[model samples]
Target: MKTLGIIGGLGPESTLDYYQRIIALYRERTGDRHYPEFVIVSVDLRKGLDFMDANDLGGMANYLLESIDKLARAGADFGIISANTPHIVFDEVAPRLPIPLISIVEATRAAAKAQNLKRLALFGTRYTMQASFYPKVFARDGIELLVPDLQDMDYIHDKYMNELVPGKFLADTRAGLLAIVDRMKATSDIDGVILAGTELPLILRDPIHDGIPFLDTTKIHVEAAIAHMLS
Candidate 1:
């Protein structure tokens, strides 16, 4: 099996999820005791979060590029950054890395298209929702992306970074998230809600949408990586 490289630790909880998911999927497919070799380059989430909160694009880009280079030097075959927000710097990171960087944007877009979705709601970091990176890519694929309202976006950012990422999953946070989903369902008429954050699935497993689908980017990303390796 081919080795995979992950640029992770944008938040530790989701990073752990990605690591476990990759191992489990690989084992399930091959039914071999040996697992695929992988490397993880976990950067300082606090710094990345601070830069994103400040809209410091240059800082974010530089951090991501450096992280990718580190992963390349550490012998990663191909790389994927686990966080959705950091993908905003993908354009900068891709060319600088010695190894190929698998794009979450492409993976998510492919998943959305496979579902024949024309419009999708997104729940992710503020950088992902407010920035042009993810939404623009989806738009190019002719899919309309709907983000939460400003207040909701703020709530998500705070709850995720302060609580969920820290492994502090509370009942109130879950209730708040469900409420946000409810509001989006009522307002957007979207075919699906994309759980763009890696940590999101930790809070919402088997998410029910009263009929609408929920696109779990973390699962989609892992499936794509496995497919790439097995193919």
Candidate 2:
């Protein structure tokens, strides 16, 4: 198997999720007694957020690129970033990385296309939702992406930074997020919800909600990384 490199700790909570899930799923899939070999470089969460908050995408790309370089030097065969928002600069950074960097967006897009999903509601940080990257990528396959209204976007971003990133999964916040999805399904005819944020699946664990599937990006990304490793 190829050595998998992960640029993690975009937030500490989701980084742990990526590590645990990759090990568990890899074991189950291969029926192996031993775990897959991998490397992780956990960067500062605050620095990344600062880059986004300042609209300094170039800085963000360079920051992630530096982390990926560390993974390469440490002997990773390929790399993947653990968070969604950093993917705003994925195109900028992937080409420069020494190892192949698997994209969370492309992986999710393939999953949606396989399911024949026409439209998906995206939930993530403000940088992810407001950015055109996800919509543009999905649109290549004729899939449409919808984000919450400005007010809901604000709420999602606030809770994401303050609660989800910090590992505080509250019932009221979960309910509020579900309500947003329900509205999108009703009004926009969405077939799926993209838990675009890695930490999202931690709070919204169920695969399906109100007949619309919640595409756990962390799971999809881990599966993609494992596939690349085994291949």
Candidate 3:
């Protein structure tokens, strides 16, 4: 099996989740105690987040490029940055790396298409929702993307990150997210919703959509990584 490399620690918790998912997936597929070989280069998330908080694209890109190079040097066969927001530097990072970076954007697009989703709502960090990285990629694949209202985006950037991602996983957080989903359901005919943030699934469970489907980007990413390794 090919070794996987992860560019991680956009936030430590989410990165750990990705690592566990990779292990669980390998165990399930191969039914062996042995796990997939992988390496992780965890970057200083405070620096990245600070750049993002200030909307400094140059700083963010530079930070990501450096991290990707470190992963390449560490002997990653293929690389993946474990966070969605940092993918804003996908163009810059992709060209610099010697190994393929399995993109969460591409993985999510494939997941949406596989489910035949025409329109989808996205919930993630402010940068992810407001910027073109995710929406542009999905649009290229002929999928329409929707974002939450400004107030909700504020909730995500301020409260979700500061409180939920770091806080102990709680029922209230799940309720709050479901409430947002309910509001989206009322306003749009979206075919589904994408949990665009890696930490989102920690708050959301079962994701009752009444009828619409929900796409978990983290799960999609894990599946993509496993396929890349085993195939």
Candidate 4:
């Protein structure tokens, strides 16, 4: 297996999740008790996130490209962005990289398809929910993605940036998030909730949510990366 590179530090907390989980998965599969060689570039995400807020996708992609280039130079055979919101510009950045790039959104889409899930409710940054990135992939696979309404979108985005990204997992925030999920379930025939943000699992760690599967994008992305490396 080639050395894995992770474009991380989009938020420090979730990057830790990606690193630890990848090591754990590798340990389980190889039984070597040693982690495979990997590189991580923890980029400053504020500027890229600001660009996304301004709808400057090219700027966001270019900003991330600089760090990704470092990973490639470090000899990673392939890499993955450890966050979802940044994947909005994955198309623009992946083409410019020396190494292949794995996409969190794409991996989750395949997972949704494999489970034959027809509908999913998304919780992530506003850019991820309002945009067509996940929706585009899901649509092609005949899956439907539901996002929180405008008010809930604001709430989710705010909590994500101010709370979850900072590693402050408040009980009230968890309840609020679950309330939205329950609300969505009551109003729709959604099959599951895609905790689309990588840091979301910190708050919503259970594999199931209100009896529906929690489609954990972080876990899905790491599992797929491990499979690719071991294959």
Worst 10 residues of 4 by lDDT: 90-99
**Which residue runs of candidate 4 sit more than 4 Å off their true CA positions?**
none
**CA shift of 136, model 1, Å:** 1.3
Model 2, 124-201: lDDT tens digits are 999999999999999999999999999999999999999999999999999999999998988899999999999999
Highest TM-score among the candidates is held by which one? 2
For 1-231, candidate 1 gives per-residue lDDT tens digits of 567889888889999999999989999998889888889998999899888778887898888888778877887778788988888888876666778878888899998988899888888887788878888888887999999999999999899878988899888898898788888888887778889888888987875567778888899899989887777
Residue by residue across 1-231, what tens digits does model 4's lDDT show?
888899898899999999999999999999986877899998887877789878998889888888888988998889999999988888877668888888898899999888989989999998899888889888998899999888999999999999999999999999999989988899887889999998899999889876889999999999999988887
Clashing pairs in 2: none
Root mean square deviation (Cα) for candidate 4:
1.0
CA RMSD of all predictions: 1.4, 0.7, 1.4, 1.0
lDDT of 3 by residue, 1-231 (tens): 888989888777888899999999999999988978899998987898899889898899888877777777888788888888988888876676678889999999998888888888898988899989888888887899999898877876675688656856777767777777778889876778898888887777575467867788888999999998998
Quantify all predictions' global Cα lDDT against the true fold. Answer: 0.85, 0.94, 0.84, 0.89
For candidate 3, the clash count comes to 0
Candidate 1: stretches off by over 4 Å: none
